[model samples]
Every structure is written in C-alpha cells, then in structure tokens.
Target: MFTLSDMWTFFLAFFLTLPLVTLVHEAGHVLAARAFGAKIKFTLGAGKTLFKIGPLEVKRLYFMDGWCQYESLKYDKLWVHIFIYISGSLSNLAVILVINFLIYQGTLPVHIFFYQFVYFSVYFIFFSLFPFKTGEGQPSDGLAIYEVIKYGKKADPID
Candidate 1:
C-alpha cells in the first residue's frame, strides 16, 4: 500500500534525486569533452530556459532530460569518442560505488534518500548504456559509442 509518506518520498525522488543523477551523468560527458579539448554546451532539461551560466543552462523541466553538445575534439580519435560516450555511465557508477562505500563504512547514515539516489543512478546508467536512437533521431550515449566504434563516425554528428 502506498502511504502519504511514500508519496512524498516518490515526489522527492522524482523532482530532486533524479535530476541530480542526470546532472552527474551529463557532467561526465562535459568533463570528457573538456579533456579532449572540445568546445561544449551543457544543457539541463528542456522548454523555457531558467538560466544560463556560461556553457551550463538550466531549464524549467530540468528533470525531464539533459545533454552535452561538443564541437569536434582536438584529439578527434576513435578512442576519444568512445570515452566521451561511455563517461556518463562511468560517472554514475563511480558515484554509486562511493556512496555505497560511505554507507558501509558508517560514515553516512543509511537512508531512503541515498538509496533512491543510488537506484536512480543505476537506472540512468542502464538506460544511457542501452543502444537506441530516439524518435527525434537523437542517439543515446550507448548508441553513439556503438556507432563510432562500428562505423567510425556518429550517424548524426552533433558537431
């Protein structure tokens, strides 16, 4: 049975935790792009723009989605593309492992919030790593990586 408390938790997880996880995932891509000397734009969400600070933009529907767009990398190597595409999932995994370690060591109290964060982080990783192109013709992180490795170029190159 779903109680009022459960509903509140769900709301919190949906609005707050999920977006934070998404940001972490997107940040991974941005970091990788920066490492490869690519000019990038990182947007968090869709619809009306709430604010723009440098390359990072926050939108009204922040929890809906996020993406990192980068110009051609200085390296421009096959390995660079693969690393950029895979970094998002890797970042989420790193966060999950760190949180789990903290909880296990009794440094952080075991709580539902942390649990939800880890859960959503894993969810992000799984979906991000699942190869598929969206109806809008946008390739997912996994799909992009697969395309680069298999075809040696992104089918829909953002750059």
Candidate 2:
C-alpha cells in the first residue's frame, strides 16, 4: 500500500538518517586519519562542490553518497590503515549503543520512526562490517582487516 504519508516517511528517513549516519561515519575516518598525521580531504556527498571551508567540502544536496579520502596516507603500515577504515563502522556502533542507553534512561521517546532510524543505522554499520565481496571481489573493512592480520599486505583486496 502506498500513500502520501508513506512518501513523507521515506523522505524523512532519507533526510534525517543520511546526515547523522554520514556525519558520524565520516567524522570517524577524518578523526582517525588526523590522528595518524594524514592530510584529510573528504566529500560529504559527490557531484558539484557546494562550498569548501578549510578541510571540509560540502557537495551537492544529493546527500546519498559520501566518502573520505586522505592525502599522503602511510601505506607502509597495515595497522594504521586498518584503524582508519574500521573507525567509521565503529562510530555507527557507538551511536547504536548511545541510543540504547537513552532509551533505557527514558530520555528519547520510543517511536516507529526512531526504531526505523535505528534499524537503518544498524544496517549501515553491519553492511560496512559484513565483508561481502564486491562484484570486483573486493573484501570489506572487516574482512580486509582479517586478511591483513592473517595473510599480510599481499592479501589486501583493494591493492
């Protein structure tokens, strides 16, 4: 069944959920990269650049796609790269944890939309961690980390 209200929900879900998820996830990458002394330049979304202020670039209002790209990343160390890649999903996991706490303490009211938001957030977290090989047979962050630990740099799927 389709209705105007359902359409609204869909829109709200995209608008509200995208920003929160993108911010937390991308911030994780940016922060970790900064810690590792990597130059940070990342897109909030792809398309035309809406504006740029210092290290941050705000792209098109499309808002569906975002990725972090570091300049002069240290490729010599496996562990540091692993930390940067894993931080995004870890931040999403942190959000799930905090939300659970808020629900437990009765700070945030439980509602359908909130549950949907949580589900969406969790979905993104797990999807990033899932390690399913892409069409190009590339391993995910979790799987890539495993390969690095067990097999060494030669096993990295991206390279």
Candidate 3:
C-alpha cells in the first residue's frame, strides 16, 4: 500500500539521508588531512555554485556527488596517507555504529529516517572501499590506499 505521504517519506529519506552521509564521509577525509596539517577543499555536487563557506562548497546539484581534496600533508608518511584514504568509509561506519547504539539503548526512537540513514551509509561504505580508479583518472580512496601500500606510489601534487 503506497500512499502519497509514504511516497514523500521515501523521497525525503533518500534526498536527506544520502547527502548527510556523503558529508560525513568527506568530513572524515578533511579531518584526517587537517590532522596532518594539510589545506582542504570539500566540494559537494557539480555545476553552478550555490554557496561557499571556508573550505566547503555546495553546488547546484547538491545531491549528485562530492569529493575532498587536500594539499600535501606535513607528515608525508605512508601510514598517514593510508589513514586519510580509509577515513571516509571509517567515518560512515562510525556513524552507523552510533545510530544503532542509540536505537538499541532507546535513546532514539525507531524511524524511517534513521533506517534510511543507516542503509545509505552502508551503501556508501561498500562502493568507497572498492578499489578502482575512474576513467577520469581519479583514484578511489581504496585504490589510492592499495597503490600507496603496494607500490609506494606517491600521490600527485595539488595543482
């Protein structure tokens, strides 16, 4: 039975939950980069600029995609780069754990929003950790980590 209200809830679930999850994932990268003393730019979506605040940008298509870029880390260690690479998925995992704990403890009531949040977080984690480089030559976090560890490959300099 699909009611109009149920349809709206479903739409809101995806539209709201996904972007928040994405922000969490990118924030993880930014946090790790900052820890090693690197400058960061976090861009959400593509197309015309909607707003810019500090290192964060929200574009016209806010729900389409997002990425975080950073300058060289002060540490410049293999482990530091690996940590930064994996931090995004790790951040999503942390949020899932916290939400589940809250629900289990009765601190937060069960709701469709929370469920969708958890679901999308898990979805984000899987794809982000699947090692592969894009045709556009952008290496995924997992691919970057693997390449760094396996080949001692250094990341390209920020242009």
Candidate 4:
C-alpha cells in the first residue's frame, strides 16, 4: 500500500534526482559546444542570474529548465550541431554503459543510485533523442537532429 511517507520519499527523490540529471544533461551540451569553439551563452534555469562564469550562467531557479545558446549554430556543419545536440544524452548513456562495464569487472557496488542513474539515463536519453516538443514548443535535441538530417542547416529550431 502507498502511504504518505512513501509519497514524500518519492517527491524528495524526484527533486534530488531531477537537478542532478539536468545538470549533467546540460553539461553535455556545454562541453560539446566548447569543443566546437562556438561562443555560448548557456543557462540552466530561469529567473535572474545567481552567478556567471564567462559564457555560463546559473539562474536562481536553476533546476527546472536549461538551454545552451551559441551563435552560428544554425550555420554549423551537420556533425557539429549533432554533437552539440546529442552530447548530453550520449553522456548519460556513456555513464550507464561504464557502470555496467564496472559491474561486469567485479568493481563498484550496485546500489539504488546505480539503478536510478540507469533508469533516468535511458528515460532521458529516449525522450531527448525523440522528435518532440515541450508544451512551450521547445524542440527536443532529437527533433533538432532530425530536422538537420531531413532539411539540412536551415532546419535549426534554435538560433
């Protein structure tokens, strides 16, 4: 039977897990953008800026939303844009794979976080790699990639 305590635990876990997942996911784009030498203005959340570091900005409400902005991204090569878009999901998948490898090698304990990590990795990766938009019309990374694949550079939903 589900109880109040279980509901509370679930909510608590959601908050904690969501933020970490979002950070890592966005970090994937940031890293890939940097690798492409694209000038970026990345933010992970809304509201006023809580902190700024060169091209990165952390917002006060920095847990619900995140996006990486870069100029000429719409004009970049297909591979470059693809790298920037899929890097986050790819990172999550990579982490899950590495963990599985470690488990196979008899190292690293299997625990709740491990399961949570794998679950969320596959969940987010699937959604992020799917061609869909949020209620606000923000396209998923997969949608962006599909656009590029089908229509070429002008298909960039972001600018």
Candidate 5:
C-alpha cells in the first residue's frame, strides 16, 4: 500500500526530525563532559544557522561534524576518552527512553513516538558502533574509526 509519495513523506519527516534528535543526543555529551569538568566549545548544527550563541567556528562539509569541542585536555587516558566518546550515544539512548515513557503514558501519538524512537535508536547504534571522525575529510567515518580504535575494544564489535 506504500506509494513513492508515501515513502518520500516518511523520509522527509524522518530527516526533519533528525536534527532535534541529534541535538538532544549531542546535548547528552555536552552535559556529561561538563559534569566531568570539560569546557564545551560549541554545538553546531547543519544548514542556514539555526541559532548560534557562542564562538563562530568553521563550517565543515559534513553536517554531522558539528560538535562541542572541549578545552585543551590530554587524550592519553583511555577511560576518560572513552567516557567522552560514549556520552553522545548514551544521551541519545536516554532521549529514546524518555520518549518511550511519554508514549507509554499516552502523552504522544503512536506514530510520532515510534518515529522518534526508531530514528534515535538507529543513529545511536550507528554512532556508538562507528563514531564521527574529525579529520581526513571524512568526518563522520573518521569519528567511527577513532571510536572503534579507542573504545570499541572495551565493548563488543558492531558486527
């Protein structure tokens, strides 16, 4: 019963909601990092300046490269690095749980709640398994490699 138009609508809605899910997900890392005494630089978003309040940073090609860089700190310790690395995914999962709770309590429509849950769940799993890289011109892919090298060993491999 799904037509091309229907599929397009689904994709459009999914993309539109992605930023919100991403912001909440990234905010998780920002909060966690701050809790551990790391200073957040900025949390950038994709396309046409949604609303910025801090320093003006360079606009990278990949939208997902938008990040909250911390103050100068040593990346020598694996545990600390791992914590920072995993915080974003943790935050996303937290959002999923909150949304799920709302859905359970009948506060959100089933369609909207389900869409958010699935969207965040996919992003969380993907990012957790493969983080966004900063350099090499492949920010998203590179992050995943960095994360895998840094924290993947601490947990099970994605595959």
Candidate 6:
C-alpha cells in the first residue's frame, strides 16, 4: 500500500527530474545540430513564453498547437539530418551512463536517491528516442530515420 507522503514524493521527484532531463537532451540536439551547421531555437515548457530570443516568427500549429521554428539552409546530405536526430537520445544515454558509473563508484547514495535518478534518466532516454508525433504526420527522429533507411527515397529499398 502507498501513502500520501509516498505519492507526494513521487510527484515531486518526477516534476523536478523531467525538466532537467529534457533540457540536457535538447541541449544535446542543439549542440550537435550547431556542430553540424544547423540553426537553432529555444523554448520552455508547453505554455506561452515567459520570454523568447532571436526573431519571433510564428510556425504552424501541430499536435501541440504551435512550436517555435528555427530555419536553417536545408542540407541535402542525409548524414547531417541523422546526426541532429540522434544527438538528443545519445545525450540522455550519456547521462544514464554517468549516473550509473557514479552509483557504482559509491559517489551517490545507493537507495532512494539513486533509484529515483536512475528511473528518471531511463524514462527520459526512452522518450527522446520515441517522441510523440505531431499532427503533421512525421514520426520522431529515431522512427523517421528508420523509415528513411528502410524505404530509401521512394518505396524502393536501397541497394
């Protein structure tokens, strides 16, 4: 049986951890994209902005109603796109690895703290790899990459 305190702890831990995890994951994407010569934009949470930076241009609404768009010169090469897609998930995995290493090396507590951190990191990694699709009918990065590779440019398989 669970008590109110336990429920409160879970909620508090989840809310605290989710944003941190998301920021790190998104940072990974932003950094990798920039490294690969792509432009970037930033946003916070799901609500109207507390503030924004750069040019404030409106993008079309999708699953979430709207997203701030950052435009970059289109890259013809698939590798750049792949890198941008995979970087966020890779960053989350890196966090998981670092946390696990710290726990193993006795740098972090072994009980509740360790458990919650590990749980949050793992869930964050999963979500980054398989984000909810927008109403535009595009799959998440990982899924899109899989489809692109599987079907080639058309319905034909790549030789």
Clashing pairs for predicted structure model 6, backbone only? none
Ranking by TM-score: 1, 3, 4, 2, 6, 5
Between candidates 1 and 5, name the one with more favorable lDDT: 1
Model 4: residues with Cα > 4 Å off, grouped in runs: 1-12, 73-75, 154-159
- Clashing pairs in model 1, backbone N/Cα/C closer than 3 A: none
Best by TM-score: 1
Candidate 6 per-residue lDDT, tens place, 57-119, comes to: 222211122222223525535666666667777887888788889888988767765566667
| Candidate 2 clash pair list | none
When 2 and 4 are scored with lDDT, the better candidate is 4
Least lDDT summed over 10 consecutive residues: which range in candidate 3?
Answer: 150-159
Model 5, position 26: C-alpha lDDT score: 64
How well is each residue in 1-159 modelled by candidate 2, as lDDT tens digits? 879779887777787777667778878878888887778776687678899877788888746656666656555477877887789888888888888889889999887666766787787778777767655566666776777677774222211
lDDT by candidate, in order shown:
0.90, 0.73, 0.88, 0.76, 0.56, 0.57
Model 1 residue 153 lDDT? 83
Alpha-carbon runs more than 4 Å astray in model 6: 53-76, 111-113, 135-138, 147-159
Per-residue error at 118 for model 5, in Å?
3.3
Order the candidates by lDDT, highest first.
1, 3, 4, 2, 6, 5
Candidate maximizing lDDT: 1
In candidate 2, what residue range of length 10 has the lowest lDDT sum? Answer: 150-159
Error of 1 at 44 (Å): 1.0
Alpha carbon lDDT at 120, candidate 5:
59
The TM-score of candidate 6 is 0.71
